[model samples]
Target: MNTRSQTPIPNVDDTTGEYATFARVQVDRWRDGQRETVEDVVAEEVPIALEYNGISHAVMMATPADLEDFALGFSLTEGIVATPGELYECEIVPGCEGVQVQMRIATERFVALKEKRRNLTGRTGCGLCGAETLEQAVRHPKAVAQGGAQFTVQQLHAALEQMQARQQLQQATGATHAAAWMDAQGGIVLVREDVGRHNALDKLIGALAEAETDFSQGAAIITSRASYEMVQKAATVGIGFIAAISAPTALAIRLAEETDVTLVGFVRRQGHVVYARPHRLR
Candidate 1:
């Protein structure tokens, strides 16, 4: 099978042949002296190559868990396939170098995906690709239905806090991002984390779809900056509102306005800035 490779979690100490190490530190104790310590750990990245009808499309570095979600979400967001059913098969093949995700889409979708392909390349952090122009790079998704979503400022504030508290991988590595679903009652119902911000949001969408959650009745809370693609993804999945812990880019704001997505940025413990579609939030 065609495969893609990514960096695996490296071993910290050769003594145990494991991904851990020991450290010694000098401490000025009143009654005791310095001490030595040991810790066990591993680092893993999600390396996935998207193949459509057996042709390689793109490879991304992400957290190697929930790969089925990653494949489906990426396919949907990138316009590779119109619906999840277009993707017929997916599998993860582990290798000595990294994990290779193989996906097979319908023949019709594969042809369309091939025609839309560009010479674009991806780095560890890049999300948008295959765009021939700046405008294409920021293609706006259709507006989401407002659909009776109403939440007080207090509820939004509480939801942001709840999303932050649920980011377990971010707390552990300080290197991951999270996307969460919050009900009008300020309760977070679902959360997904990943090394890549886009992947985190994709995982959340996949999880919501898998659970048959009612996304139109709630909002999405993200623990990262709001980007144009992020806004597009939320809107694509029929989310009416999105709250982020950081600022939204100008393009992101424009897209949110066109897409009828309520965009809130600079969200803190007490307040937030509404950039677009404020009507959704009461």
Candidate 2:
């Protein structure tokens, strides 16, 4: 892939003010009997350095949009902060190299983060990196409240359709992942996209918290396979339902069961497989 782009430029639409998350690049296309140069749009992936109280923490490859949500959500889900209030300020600084999310969190939370030594070099495809200990590598989340929300199969299908329709970035680039929040009636309320699946989920989680929505009252829909980290993030925020467009890892199933989350995978228009707490789907 010899595609080239500038440092994740944010092109805002004049009317809607929606950030353009893709970059136009020139590429060679080989068809059945032809080869030609063409202009294409690719999802933007850039290094996002997260700084806490001026201390550099993890550097991740992610799409540079909704970064404020990403910082807050990452802080909360990663156990750096117990509540949203613990995070006082989030500032995004874009540079020629990449983007930086400068966050000022509660003193106690920042102190705890330093104690864990959780410095990471994260890629778009992987979440865990630079963990020095087994305990730090695989941390468990608090168990979510049991038996909170239920969704019918029809609602699941409807939400899946809605989410797919709403993913403008994926439609444009086909290189991004989406995470959405589905209300109790299966209406897709909020969606976030990123080059990294975990980043998308973190954005959605952060947006939900910022909107003051009850995490336990709805479900999360992801366009990627469910990993243990995904389950942990959702459970940490008390989301009881998680539906993935692909399969679930064994570790994800185990964590979902332990956290009282209803995990569903291979979600399509016709069917889905429930990996845990099947009763949540009627």
Candidate 3:
């Protein structure tokens, strides 16, 4: 089991913990009525199994990078663990079939996880997998703290601009989504990329938590549409502001309003749309 982080490379085997998140392959190209062969890079989605206290909990298809962060983040956002302290140790084990993140969590949290009795096979786009009832599927977290942090339109736009250059994985494979943590001054603090947008956010959250980041003083910037699950994750972690480069779902807006999260979407250089809690933005 390797917990150290590694950079993703092209077209590598998965027998080791440092598995490649992208692969380079040959592709047929047609341009101007001419056909040729070219090498292309594509994002690799692996079945990442999350095991808590040696019990298999859920499996998600995600890029293999910053997986330790992913494990902690998933645990936190999925309510498996109430706080980062509840998660003790995370081991990244790569195998021929896929990767397994074996986590050792607090006994109390593990007991609660077992009580929920959820065995999810999560896909890249599906967040609520194997949920039996509506209540289990649409979970609402506690409301975020009021008047924690605020950002202006200029800061949001500047963060959006800075985030583009920091997305190394997306620039390589063009098949991954990115989630970045931006401070109030519009500086991109950290970025995480994954095949699944939710996974990316989870990874970012995990990294931020590991660094003891102040969730109230920064915003989450995502390069995908804002979904209800995204808002739920942010609010659960006490993130007061979120900005998306694309549109946000109606359910996401409603949850943001209910959770006192400032949700902004369609973020561009010109302007952006504030769907909920406009007071958070200047």
Candidate 4:
């Protein structure tokens, strides 16, 4: 698969892996039948290549920041590694055209990954983009480990409110999505943001792994709508319940039902819709 991590571009933050998230640009402003020049900060989008065992896997278009966390989260949520330790090493090498995240995995896992690669694999953002068959497209996640946690609508609202405070990049760019881990008591534990909602969730999931968190113990919230792929990614790691500030795709709701996850959407202060597994909600 040719995941083009866009051709490398010259950057100011060459020394630090932290590439700039946005750049100032001059644009013509037209409002009230008036025209003026204004400086605007636009979110930076770059190609981020993920290479496993020295071989390329995916090239994702993403905002360049919190990459180490991105690498870990992508690996775990993608089922490339069952545990954080299965991934041995990850290195970031900026190329002439894009950035490459080189990852080394346990030998056995590496072998399994290769064995699973087939003629029909690797797709774009959709969960089944690269799927070769219906069975693969609808692959089920492992049963969630048991956990007893319940919360009120107020708690879910509070947790989402907390997410708003931690979104440094999104607040600045207005072009990013955030996926956050929130405790049952409405505490925002971790947040990861990306231009891609999947990437944001993946990064947050990775950060949780780095902290050795029990996925079943908390809920997930996304600033964007929840899709089947989002639910699949969360379920792959046993995230039992997920809330979205927007709506849920029909497929996402169906998958949530099959995966035994609580799918909540339109998470406003006054109300929220529970699509599946409402037993987990109070």
Candidate 5:
């Protein structure tokens, strides 16, 4: 509905194109008589405003990549709409302030959305926002249906290692988080990264939806702590297991137990602790 010009932000350089012109430099610390330069890379944060059916919903500041997935994932995880098809259309309107993601949803869903609107006053460190109450913060989804999602110890270890290797942004900026989905055989099939941990998971979910990947037969691996919200998001996708590199909160553990999603925490180089639903892991 709105139109504006958009410019690309430079992040990767491989000796091709304009980004290649900037040469790497080395810097040294000098007290008083020398000058030096440090090798540096630049990243930009763009504001993304989500509007549902001509009504303003929420805005987020994130790296301007995989926007379509971001929009769809946000809508589904935030409960704006049940499925991606509920979003009739989505367009990116660029402005000096930020990129506005204008989304059109079903009329009935829009009416439901307006009632849940809250004044999100500040930028969120994570992609989660606009919750007016504490109960909303801990919104729970039905537990995943246990089918035949069983993983061996060897497969679990391999999935964790694969997830680590797929963190390209973390390797570059050292400031991003990643969430990955691994299939039953333990191969990391899809990985998403973002400045926000929740956003990374959302993007992963969105990508899965777009690619039509089957989540019922795999697990979700994250590079951060397993919080209650994280557990909820994983459960929303019907993931049978969630393995994290950090500890799980009490709420997260409780939700995992209730949802029947296997929760594994403290996943490190060689060991991990299964907090809940250990039956999924062999």
Candidate 6:
């Protein structure tokens, strides 16, 4: 029942936006050549400011839901904290422009975070937009210690089908992306949706870390394209494989190769493309 953390499950009251997933707006709908006024549902994108130890780190545009997960995931994948234990507690504070996810972390991590970046913020689609240089932008993750996670082509297809059932946010607004964790046989376990693909993956990684799932037993499935940063995030979190509904970029493929991650893309009901470590997915 505690959604804030995996370690102690902080006793703080939940300040996350329970009803802020989507909003309704009036729009014109065309039916049989006739346009009529109707209500349209859109995904809610809010500014999520991440502050570590009261110091502003990054203000990202994300769905105002499961922000605690977002904070934990972002911290791990972004290299702010080496482990989830470093994060003590997360305080969600809603403001005029957006929600500020205040994370109480170890002083060492906070000091390192401050030394890494003085100020950083990014929108949904901007990967490493705030990084100062190419080296900082493409910080590669250490290769996965355990790779060669095997799955069948049929399992990949089934995983894609299961991912659809968990995409509630995308079904509602048709504008959000989802990241799901599925067992090796292709059973959906945990899913997180967000306006940003990276954030969605971060949330999923946070959940995976909480559950401490065996990396060899499952793979990550994403609703968006597999970018270089996506592979980096997966490798950073020690995910052995990734299946995406779209294609993988050149940089993503290269990163997957270097990180020893099995990357699969264009995952539909019938087929998929293996961009990296094809031997892992039959």
How much does candidate 3 score in TM-score? 0.93
Compose the digit string of candidate 3's lDDT tens values, residues 157-242: 88898899999889998899999999867799899999999999999999999898889889999999999999999998999999
Shift of residue 4 alpha carbon in model 4, Å: 16
**Per-residue alpha-carbon lDDT of candidate 5 for residues 1-282, written as tens digits (9 for 90 to 100):** 657644443323545422221223365646588766666543445667878777777777676667788888878877778887888898977666667789999999888887776644226455346577877767888878877478987888888888888877677667677899888777988888877777788888888877877778888889899988888888887777899999999999999999898999998877999999899888
TM-score of each: 0.82, 0.94, 0.93, 0.90, 0.85, 0.91
Q: Which candidate tops lDDT?
A: 2
Query: Would you list the clashing residue pairs of candidate 5?
Result: none
lDDT of each: 0.75, 0.90, 0.89, 0.82, 0.77, 0.83
Count of residue pairs whose backbone atoms collide, per candidate = 2, 0, 0, 4, 0, 0
How do the residues 1-282 of candidate 4 rate in per-residue lDDT, one tens digit apiece?
Answer: 998765345254556646777778899999999999999877777788888898777777777777888899888877779999998999988777767889999998888777766222232343455555677677678656666467777788888889999999888879889999888576998888888888888889888889898888889999989988899999998999899999999999988988888999999878899899998888
Q: Please give the lDDT score at residue 175 for candidate 4.
A: 88
Query: lDDT rank, highest first?
Result: 2, 3, 6, 4, 5, 1
Candidate 2, residues 211-240: lDDT per residue as tens digits? 888898899999999999999999999999
- Candidate 4 clashing pairs, residues 3+ apart or interchain: 7-97, 8-96, 8-97, 8-98
CA lDDT, candidate 2, residue 61: 89
CA deviation > 4 Å runs, candidate 3: 1-17
Off by over 4 Å in 4: 1-10, 14-17, 118-127
> Model 6 off-target regions past 4 Å?
1-17
> Residue 239's C-alpha lDDT in candidate 2?
95
- For residues 1-282, write the lDDT of model 6, one tens digit per residue: 766634211222247525368777999999999999999998888888899888888988888777878898999999998888999999998766678888999998888877776477789877787887677888889988765457888877877787898789899899999999888667888899999999999988887776776766789999989998889999987888998999999999999989889998998878778888876776
